[model samples]
Target: MAHHRTFDLLSRLPKVDLHLHLDGSVKPETLLELALHQGIDLPVYDREGLIPHMRVGEECGSLIEYLSKFHFTTRIMQSGEALERIAYEVVQQSAEHNCKYVEVRFAPQLHRNNGLTVEETIHHVVEGMKRGQRDFGVRGGVIAICMRNHSCQSNLEVIEAAAQFVGKGVVAVDLAGDEAAYPPEFFREVFAESTRLGIPVTIHAGEAAGAVNVYEAVTNLGAVRIGHGVRLKENRSILEMVKERRIPLEMCPISNIQTKAVSSWEAYPIREYLEQGLLVTINTDNPSVSGTDITNEYRVLSDRFGFTAPELVKLIMNGVDAAFLDEADKLLLRREMENEISSLGVSL
Candidate 1:
């Protein structure tokens, strides 16, 4: 049996985060500052007053309610400077937590209401992420989001913008937004274009909907990864298929509990899925929105599910395996992680 590891050791462990949202992870203080700087209106002017409206955990009623917070965040993230700052802050935070590599994602179209084109949004975001990499020495990548609730025409623009930055820094494309109302079928053609452009795909599914949505995302949209796939455990056949295919599931415990996707941390299927030999990678779907971070996420898995140091190592390895990085980069990351662990007197 595996024994639990101390939080201090976990904190020192090198990590990979593949499913963080930029719009959802902006710091409260930063949000307030941006609102004032951008001349954007906000119901609250200070961090203490704004945190309640921004951080939604168990109080979050549903996915829609959790997502509603984006309205305030997106308002401040419209300009190039705002986007750059948020991107830099996200990577900086990840670096502080010992995350060696991270993939930050957001829908470019959401920022276009302020007169920025989708391309401009992607450019600024990539620039910011690059700046963070230089400053923190923590490598980062961008994943342009194609919102499901938006029209195919709108998603097409996002896909085109993503294609323009494939090797530059945009590593992959993803589908996000209301999962139940807008199925993967709606974005099939857009994902196809992304595939043709050699961009890997991940889709938000099985969170607000059923396992069939997960199936559709994999079969129709070519999603190599699934976000918030908490519901996939409900169907054994689908679970078995996912296991057989080695499809990685980006499971966010606190976010799921806050969104009411799962009842609580104890009820989350993370341990069960791991026991069943599924490739489950822990993540923070929306850190600020859920009032959590990568370290807190690992702590939850340890306290709630009894994930020991070895199991935690496996979880991080799962993220490394699922990253959208190139083969050479992946190999280099693996070596670095191994060396980091050896220096800390730990082993896989």
Candidate 2:
């Protein structure tokens, strides 16, 4: 039998987070400060009082209710200064938790309500990620997300604007929002442009919907990775299609459970997927909103699923393989993770 490790050891290990959301991950104190700076009226003025409004947990009713937290967060992320600060702090926090790499994602369209263009919005996030990397030594990238509820024309404009910074700062594009309502077929033209530009693709599916959505995201939208694909097990054929394609599934344990994406903790399916030889990578979907960090995510697996050191390391490697980076960077990151573990006097 495999023995679980302590939280301290888990915290020290190098980590990779690929599905993190920028708006939902902002610090409560920072959100309050931004609210005050912008003179935006928040329901609460203090961080403590504001947390209940911004953060959520397992008791949250459904994915829709959990997503409601972003309504307040987007209000504060309207300005370039606020966006830069939030993006920088995301990587800074990643370093504090020993995350070697992360991909911070957000809908550029959501930040444009304050009169900024989509290009300007992406620029601020890229600038912040650059500064964070220079200072914290954490390598990361920005992902531009298009909302499902938005018009196809509107989403196309966002995708075209983001393509300008693909390699410069933005690494990939993603789809988010009410998956059940919009479905993957709705974004065909929007993601078609992404494919034409040779940009990597990932989509939010199988969380609030069924496995068919995941199938469409892959078969239609060219999603190289599926975010919160926790519900893909609903269809064996579609699940096998994912496996046969070698497409990785980005799983966020805390967020999935909190959103009721699964029936219960036992049905989360991380172990089940692993047993079947599917590629699974752990991520922090929305740290502050979910009230979780990458460390706590691993702790949950350790406590509930008995993921030993080797199993944990396998997940890390899976993240590396699934990253949007080129082969050279991915190889280098894998080596650094291994060397760092050795230096800590721990063997994988």
Candidate 3:
């Protein structure tokens, strides 16, 4: 009964997802159906069989192994329609969970293996998200990702394609992939191009690597937010830098646990960071990949960390503040969210 009430309250709260990946959030059922429709070959023939292979187990070895799951999902997402369906479903799912805004990201270079142009890939995803917004009232934005493992030239090409959609539907540009293998310093010039065009930047850092990576992401790549920045807790200087600059850490607790990003749930740093008055936001870094959602993320925070309605409200509002929306949109969201949350017995 308590769990049900908690879920009901959580569903009623307005939310924002800052670090969702399009290719990483495809549903298992949808994956099987899409595979059949596209005539793509799969190792497993059924959803149950495919799920165990797709979703990483609780003891995922390393960040590289954790990311390899995308190979299967991205292979099937090369077609324009597949990209559209994935983006559309992402928005629909976010809306169903009461997420008022979201920033969905994907690496265009990953989808071009099947011969589709990068612009076409971005166009299809934006089209699907726009359709979802029109139907479900969930405001959506895209973030073009440049993989760390890919060639610099290819990443530059992705930047050019992403810059074209700066104000159209794409919200920001991001760097993703094996952070430990490819440092943020390598993409210095690429991120400079994004900065020159006034495009916001976010980087996947302090997850597979260390605080040095987080430092480079902000100092070199000009990142406004850090994705899965759970490791930022280890270094005091990095923590101070984040707090001083007010850089938001997009924290995905379950995903971190599954990837062994942190040793255990007891050692999670989000609550500690919050207690220190740092800017932090809760996110489902990869819903389907992590087999979790924004609501479940909140439930874990509540049940495991003893977060109350007020504390949960603060985290949700952090997402609002950290969103890639413009000032006017942010103001509108703040007012709307405040009204809704306060009515639900959340105090400010």
Candidate 4:
């Protein structure tokens, strides 16, 4: 234990991130390039100047405020070329940080503010991700997202578009944004359509809303996974349901604090959830926006929760289990991580 630097070991370990946001994952340099190519005027051109606009700090009061940061990045992603390039960069960055698998989520309607159709938007992302896997050996796909704030009819269209790409490069469908104002109750028909289309469902619930939203997501929306289920802890019955059903919770500690999902790091429920038998996976909700990555997440969490080698392996495996990969692929990924960790000389 003394011989190994925990960060080094964690960095080399294979990882999975199921909650990352494609719109929020744009590289600062890439943002500048897209802005330049599109003639979009930004307040800053350099990385130092551009990064602050992309990220939120303690001043970020609520989920909606934190979401305001995406205006810069998402505005730049209107073109298919820009989306493809950003997708490629996401894979390259994930691979560089040793992520074996990842699922980048984005609302297709965001890109459609320009002339791009939803299908075209997904096609470009798929092509970019395919190219990344071809060159970088990191395999992953996209989760098409339905924004909660949209009209119900519009959300149904988004899910319909997502359903078309289910086997192509898209893995699942997720509901994101302003969950407090737009509860899962209103989106039942939208996700019901997803389940009917054979697309797996994950919802952003109990995030800006209460545990009741989490309950509605599970019972009404047919959500197989809950994104940022922090507030679920507020309701014992709902918490027990999540634990009893073994629904994976995508817990992002950094973004949770930045969005005030929890009051502080000490208040975050990762350790408590794990101890209480809730299946939990650590993820970077947005790498660029949160200014963190998979390795950095594992390390910071280790510092706060006192996670050792075996516990760290549990965290990584939790990600593998919760990943959208098929069973055989999950087995292969598990073996790859185990072999890599073993070769790194860290006993797990």
Q: Kindly list the per-residue Cα lDDT of model 1 for residues 1-348, writing each as its tens digit.
A: 223447788788999898999999999999988888878888878888998888885667999999998897898888999999999999999998999999999999999888999999999999999999999988879999998888889998999889999999998899998887888787889898888888888999999998988998898898889997899988889888889999999998889888888887767888899999989998898888888889889988888877777889999999999888889999999999989977877778
Residue 82 lDDT in candidate 3: 94
* Models ranked on lDDT: 2, 3, 1, 4
User: What shift in Å separates residue 216 of candidate 1 from its native position after superposition?
Assistant: 0.5
Candidate 3 local distance difference test against the native: 0.89
Question: How many steric overlaps are in each model, in order?
Answer: 0, 0, 0, 0
| Model 2 Cα lDDT, one tens digit per residue, 1-348 | 223337777899899999999998899999988888888998878879988898886689998898999998998999999999999999999999999999999999899888999999999999999999999999998999999999888898888988999789899999999877888998899999999998899999999999999999999999999998998898999999999999999999999998899989989899999888889999999999999999989988989998887788888879989999999999999999999877866776
List, residue by residue over 1-348, the lDDT tens digit for candidate 3: 998988899988888898899988998888999999989898888888888767887878877788989988998998999999989999999998899998899999989878999899999999999999999999979999998888888988888898899889999999998887888899999999888888899998988788888999998889999987888888999889989999999888888898778888998888899999888899998888888899889988999998989899999999999999999999998998899888888798
Clashes of 2: 0
Q: Candidate 3: which pairs clash?
A: none
For model 2, the superposed segments whose C-alpha errors exceed 4 Å read 1-5
TM-score of model 1 (CA atoms): 0.97
Error of 3 at 340 (Å): 1.5
RMSD of 3: 1.2
Q: Tell me each candidate's TM-score.
A: 0.97, 0.97, 0.97, 0.97
Q: lDDT for each of the candidates?
A: 0.89, 0.91, 0.89, 0.88
Scored by lDDT, the top model is 2
C-alpha lDDT of residue 303 in model 4: 88
Can you tell me which runs of candidate 3 are displaced by over 4 Å?
none
lDDT of 1: 0.89
Candidate 1, residue 113: lDDT: 80
Cα shift from native, residue 190, model 2 (Å)? 0.9
